[model samples]
Target: MTLRSKPYHWLYAFVLIALSAFSVQSVAETSMEQTGELQLWHKISLIFDGPETSERADYNPFIHYRLNIIFTHPATGDRFVIPGYFAADGNAANTGAESGNKWVAHFSPNHTGLWKWQASFRKNRFVAVSAKVDAGVSGGFMDGQQGQFTVSESNKELPDFRAAGRLQYVNEPYLKFAQSQTYFIKAGPDAPENFLAYQDFDGTFHNDGHKDDLVKTWEPHLTDWKKGDPTWQNGKGKAIIGALNYLNSKGLNAVSFLTMNIMGDDQNVFPYVDYNTYDRMDVSKLAQWEIVFEHAQSLGLFLHFKTQEAENQGLLDGGGTGLQRKLYYRELMARFGHHLALNWNLGEENGEWFKNHPTMPQHTNERIAMARYFYENDPYHHHLVIHNGIDYDDLFSADSHYTGASVQTHKADFSSVHTAVKRLRDWPVINGRPWAIAVDEPGDAQHSLVPDRMNPAHNNARQNGLWGALMAGGWGTEWYFGYANEHSDLTAQDYRSRDLFWDQARHSIAFFDALDVPFQRAKSHDELLSSAADYVLAVPGEFYIVYLKDASHQPTLNFKNFSGDFEINWFNPREGGEMQQGSKTTIQAKWVHKAKLNNTFNLGLPPSTPNQDWVVVVKRK
Candidate 1:
């Protein structure tokens, strides 16, 4: 599909203004760098002049001024309907301006070639309804303007998001990068839920000790901050950028954060003008956040954007369908939708968990509406999933916008990770589409993946916590800091607290990627294996991957109706090592027409490392 020019094309005159790294044009005013140095997947902003505004409190500029830049990549004929936002001022990051005429359309080209674009700016009058109603003929200066630009090859270093091109959801169980066409496997921190509660951010959490205790300086990561990296208003975000640097240095690829946690734990982070306000967004604060997120993207980190924490489920626009909720969703998609890799989690532990709270709880239909709204409005339609309290079954529907499940468990010892992932992975396939399931939060309610000083071995964690999820065909696992530990989930300042556990997680991700295992094609089947401690993920006779918790005994693989010659390789799970070569094996099925013995063979293979955990890989030869 291509983004064709709007009607009345002859009325507006197009002028090719000289730029450094971008090409921009409009009827009245345009702002963009020259396209000579643009790279694939690098966010480039095309600024345009709009109506001047003083207050966005009563009427949200996000919903009222709907500016869309329809971009068409010439080489591939791929079209992207990118949203535009009202940037209070062109330099909102430097100067804290809440209202102005600076409007912008951010674009990150998936392909390296010339791309054409046109803007469709409209004014909607209603703030109560979700649909758009025309506000007469007169509009902003840059409405219906068109132009084109070019994108060069990415010179971005490895482990950087700019190097990955666009991260797209291709109706599969995982997200894939447009450049390499490789599926992503996430492994990182899911805690420090208040990751955005930075000291420099323009907000205060000084209401109570619970909120104030979680305020972060990010001091440990200060050394990782580079000279030319994104820093706002002198040195506002060195520490937060440094935190992402620390995560990338540790080989972690994803991080989760609550953008708003009003009336909840760490009630510090919100996009509103202030803690009490909800109509308008804090432009300067959001701009600073963009700096942090942009740096994270450059580091190749997957942003798991947890939009709302539990307590604020009904706080916005009458529990989802009202104008407040619509405005919030539209603003998020407008500002950050151009990001290469991210997921908009509807709400953390969403649904009616709080009965005695002041606000009305969110109903099932409201949650569905929220997801459906994002599915319809967001042009990118990046992975849209909802976090759960306990009951997530109602949210699963082929018609809904939930592309995956971000599960949270209360089970102690995390023994439930395997079954939970298995069921979630299998149930979606039973539905119309497959879901990319991840155990975002797992383990006990207390002491989950604490410092190495407390739990160094991490036997339960390695065996049940990490391996169980992977063995069940789970996409990835992120460590959730428990409440009972020091620097717990909300108050974690240093990421090194769970350093050893990260090593184990990275080893698992490396094992699959290095082997080039067709994990997406594999299915988890516990019925094929005899031992309860053993888990099998196989693609029939093509490939079989087995994970043994107790490697002392061998597990039987019943090749009932299959005949194939296979090569076996074993990998140590606890201690990361190369795939050890094993013997070639054959499984013969029963034969009748050929006059052969009518019998099947059940192969029992010995463990590579006895009494220790191991992963056995069998490939058809």
Candidate 2:
């Protein structure tokens, strides 16, 4: 029953037709420019035609050649220096070429008008740092090139990364999209670790013994494959691309997948030429992956790039500062860093938990070094976060490159999500920088978030998984399907498994957006309520949201030293209903229920739905 052994290979032709319908727009143009005319925020690639060199297996081209491009925005005089990478033939996605003289530089313009670029190709014995050396003597044909192009104003509509401009981490507790002033909140899947195990792309996992049965056709998402969307080589990625569509349609905005999972769980996804190989990249395969990522951006989906899984921590560079790991990271940034909205996760549960593992858990300094590399290299400076295992508490540091915490827990009821988020949110402030925290992985390992078929109500998941994180001022939660469940994390092929839960997630987002809740400025205080079942995220008198976790009885809120007339609204968290009117209550010194007092009030709220989770929102009148 493993994916690779599945006989869905016939669907390859079907996917090709689906992908080709949209890829006709991206089909290769006969020109030196790898990218054609692009809108603002769209990536434009400049390809330097040159002589093909040794294969990735034969020699490390990453160390021998360096391509640096500086693009200057004419209007503001803002300079952007971005690194370039080797693209084999520039059509490697379809051609699968391992050798070619196609060196490419990709740029996403911030503004429209004439932009100038200059390329400097240098041959270096040590690629990590550039020193004064022979420049022109060993350079190839594309060296010392210059060009200019006009960036037209983008015409793309909402939900696209183009509309959002760019997502940046500005040393804040949350990530904000550039120019939009909108804080991001994500809700999506954190399962099917082998998300890229599609049939069309170039990968060795299909023949590899570990996950030969792990092939996924993504058949359920086929209908979401819209025409005119980008795809590669004879419809290779229709189902997977459609998966993004299905998520977007359901109102989920973020998805996580492993870029390289060699020697780890599933062993079906990676960027290299084969499962066992590390240094050599499969150029064509990477190109195909870019196509999928591009479509996701267009759909307003956030890309979560998990670089390494725990099992393979010591596989490359021996989990130390080494050249092999540096090259892998460099290639990833060059090829995918141009993306507008993405977060680079250093590893999945990254630490040594087993006594027999080759590498010990990464030391604090090693983790800091990794973060510093991304901070220095990426021009856009997208959000950076690290997933946790047992060493979760050790990752909090004010000086680190991490912008947030990608939290994970083994509590199926998600009772710890709120407390975990609150702790990280408060702990980082001591270092003078607050970290944006997201419970990316939650629920117990064995029976995490099961599908709607088995648990249509999704009571505990809805009560704690969705609302718990949101009320705690945590950005979002991505449901992790448990391994012991039917559609577990590593084996899920259909997303409908959690259909009902997705609806609840959408409801949560809508609630915040509709009310324009200023969650960014609020703090979580569970002590505000007398009952332990109630939780509050409030700016005190200005606005207060009290979540009734138990939904059993009417709770009295202690708004100590609060005196004001307020409007109260009740919301049913479980049923996804509209706000219902609650008693018009005024707070004073020692008001009892609705009676006004001198300077305090213990406001009593009636149940919106008996025995169901509810949210009580109070705003000053």
Model 2 TM-score is 0.88
Show model 1 residue runs off by greater than 4 Å. 1-26, 29-37, 54-60, 74-77, 127-130, 133-137, 204-210, 354-358, 428-431, 582-609
Per-residue lDDT of 231-265 in model 2, one digit per residue for the tens?
77777788898899999998888888888877777
The global C-alpha lDDT for each of the candidates, from Candidate 1 onward, is 0.76, 0.76
Task: Please give the distance, in angstroms, between residue 268's alpha carbon in candidate 1 and its true position after superposition.
Answer: 0.5
Off by over 4 Å in 2: 1-31, 34-37, 126-138, 358-360, 392-394, 397-399, 550-552, 585-608
Residue-wise lDDT of candidate 1 within 189-251, one digit each (tens)? 999898998878764454434467667898887887888988888888887888898888877
Q: Supply every candidate's count of residue pairs whose N, Cα or C atoms clash at under 3 angstroms.
A: 8, 20
For model 1, how big is the CA root-mean-square deviation?
6.6
